[model samples]
Target: MSPEAPPDPLDFRPRVALASLSGEADADWARAGSEYAGAAFLGGIALDEPTREAARELVDRDRTEFLPADPVGFVDEQLAALADSPVQAGFNVRTTELEPLHEVGAVCRDRGAILEINAHCRQDEMCAAGAGEVLLRDADRLSELVAAAAETGATVSVKVRAEVPGVDLPAVARRIESAGGDAIHVDAMDSEPVVGDVAAAADLFVIANNEVRDERSVREYLEYGADAVSVGRPSDEPAVLDRVRDATEAWFAGEVEP
Candidate 1:
């Protein structure tokens, strides 16, 4: 069979995504939860030696991690398992080097999946290794990573965290857009209005995340100009997903208000 084109990041039907939760999110989790979401991001997979070691450190601290021997091959395996699901599949990956991003982007490109750069992980181990939240403060390097990922023809998204002191997320959003990124997934933390800031700054598809449990949170994010909303920790709970899905559908259908 021929390879399929990458899924359109801006065209999610339900406008809800199943966010990546470190070690828990995978093809199986995403496939089972696909019915309630328009997109499902799997794996905050560590792609390089430094990040892999950081992941190992996280594991020692009782955190889950995907430490595959062959990072690119692992992505292909995981994405292939989602081939029959209706939800758009994506991989949230961490790497300090540009080569691994390019390699994984190729896999995502061929598999019709989104390649999400991991800039939102706040784990001390990951940050100390210069992989996750470190990228939030280093917009120039993050932009280079996004550009490299985009070069492989995959739809690229940067998963970012809001409210990091000294980091201007809206400014970073513009850089991502200039780097050819197709989407920006923001973990809006306590400051939900940052979603609007990001939306106003760039033409990138904005996916607002954090504390999205029901119609209220869903409506709030959408009202703030987010193109979509993502469910984080509760993503594994079908009940939560159902409520989120309904709210998202309602918002898009004009049945809800701010």
Candidate 2:
């Protein structure tokens, strides 16, 4: 008899994820396999800084050490360091150009990592350059970015904010799916039902984010159609991570009600 088929790599749910912790650079990479998080999103990298001065400011504001010089290489190193662990590395990149995103996607493919495009940033600097929330107003542009990243032979995911006023979340999900994006990481922001709507509207993976605290929150999102749930501010505490991990395990075992 033939051996059982392996589970899809991209389909692996990141039950507990480390959402781009901005303050400490070293701590971020070190927490990859901390026996808690199944995935780490190394993030908010400026893909196309206008100048070195701007880059410095971005690094300071985002509280990240990554620079434009070798963003992909940085992600590669992070992935390499977690080689012996079950943790998956995903790079969150901010860029307005399709070509650069395509390049980053290729690098992610080569480095065995996932590439997440940033559409969630609300900072003035990012929006002024049409790199973040601006993409929401232009669905065609957002879809183009997804298509370009997808063309790079890597599993591409778009990170978006669900609370963006006037932005149709389901429409955005459809645009990402139609553009061949592998997943939609929604910063749901207390909108569990909207997550379900997105999942219903699109055929891609859904990673729900925002205010996830315990088993109840995890089960709530999962039942609401989130393939996975992400933790942000609460993850700063080790205890919180522990709780989330246990909750995720129970969730997977069907011990937690959906």
Best by TM-score: 1
In order, candidate lDDTs are: 0.92, 0.75
TM-score of 1: 0.96
Error of 1 at 182 (Å): 0.9
Candidate 2, 1-258: lDDT as tens digits: 999854343654446777765334233454633567777777657666542234476667654445646755665676666666676667787777766787778877776667888888776666878777878888999899899998987888888887788999999999999999988888887676899999999998888888888877777888888878777776667777777778878888888666
Name the weakest run of 10 consecutive residues (lDDT summed) in model 2. Answer: 21-30
- In candidate 1, position 184 carries an lDDT of 96
**Cα lDDT tens digits for candidate 1, 48-143:** 999999999999999998888998999999999988889898999999999989899999999989999999989999999998899989988999
| Per-residue lDDT value at 141 in model 2 | 90
- Quantify how close model 1 is to the true structure by its C-alpha RMSD in Å: 2.2
